[model samples]
Target: MKKENLIFGIYPVIEALKSETDLDKVYIQKGIENPKIDSIVKQIESLNITINFVPIEKLDRLTRSNHQGIVAITSPIAFHSLETIVEEVLASNTLPLFLVLDQISDVRNFGAILRTAECTGVHAVIVQKKGGAPVSGDTVKASAGAIFNIPICKVDHIKDAIFYLQGSGIRTIAATEKTKNSIYTTNLNQGIAIIMGSEGKGVSNSVLNLVDEKAALPLLGEINSLNVSVASGVFLYETVRQRTQ
Candidate 1:
């Protein structure tokens, strides 16, 4: 089995940039600024590649190579464009089912939700580019490889994504505990995009305000809420049930 698939060393990572690859992220050693490095950073940024500034020690821990102060991890699956996916799905004249995540950073939860999304026949998963968990190997494993089958799009902002989806004729639903409407009652079978918040604080106010519907899963238990992943499953399967019926 391939135990590790990290592309370390500055040159190797730079070379990977030329090929058709989805890079999860790149780590650059702190305080190392040169023209060559600056140009490479610009290239990555231009390509919408995510980069992280880290200590050299961290790079060493990631690999034993003479990394020359850079490391890049290849994503298990290529990412899809939110606009393209929405346009194509809508062009099919079918009601699109999209899942928009705002600030959910836990890898396991992200992966688990993605697995449920694929099984539920979701068209795409939309996430904010920043403050989101890196789609690493662990996420791929946790997702049971569902990440490869489903479309995932990283957006600069959730609110912008909401507006874009709305303009594309997709209804945005915010899943929050504060809402009185039940998820089961919502029309998930239609052209819908569900927005799920972070595990810690729930959805942001800005994002929530833009949602066409704010619904919640019924809390029959005394806990008052469910884990984000479990809640996501409930929400996604509800859509599946509605569409099948």
Candidate 2:
């Protein structure tokens, strides 16, 4: 986290939101309430921005200057629009492959997934505006600068993105342990978008229902699931193998 990337004070944060600045998250002093703060909360909710309520001590630790009980962290990189990226990909004659992440908050996991996505030639990595990990310095380092190379889109809802992708004739596949279908058995040589979920909750039921198919990697060990990043790599490489073979 860099000080240059943070914007504090209620009015400044509100203005940033109003201007449609790309923000990863917002922090407010817990239990503090005022008309301006109320308005900020409303704006954040309407914009679907992630926010946290923390102690004044935490805010002081974050910055020495007067934060006025509010702070906003800007993303290190700009986000692309899903529709715009999809249109560009569809215009190309080659089959399009995309990765959609649902609520993957761990910066390290997010970065590793991006690395794999770039290596495997994924067209774009889509994440939700609220629950996805911030494109912070840590994520950039973890991706080994691959974040700068790949297109990333932040959508308001994962379900809406799924529906839009399907409507465009791209097959959407979800990786989950709950499904009996295996990725090895699924066809990945066509235009597709693969959905990977959070570490704790996997994909949401609503999103799982919308995908064209659900597949899982067989786990030989006792562990029931793989790390989100590792599983994503497996899914991506499988796509590569099928397309190349």
**Overall lDDT per candidate, in order of appearance:** 0.86, 0.90
Which tens-of-lDDT digit does each residue in 122-239 have in candidate 1?
9999998667777877788899999999999988799999999999888999999988998877888789998999999889998888889999988877897788999899998888
Q: Taking the candidates one at a time, how many backbone clashes does each contain?
A: 0, 0
Worst 10 residues of 2 by lDDT: 42-51
| lDDT tens per residue, model 2, 98-209 | 9999999899999999999999999999998776677776788999999999999988799999999999999999999888999999999999999999999999898998
Cand. 1 Cα-lDDT? 0.86
Q: How do all models score by TM-score?
A: 0.79, 0.82
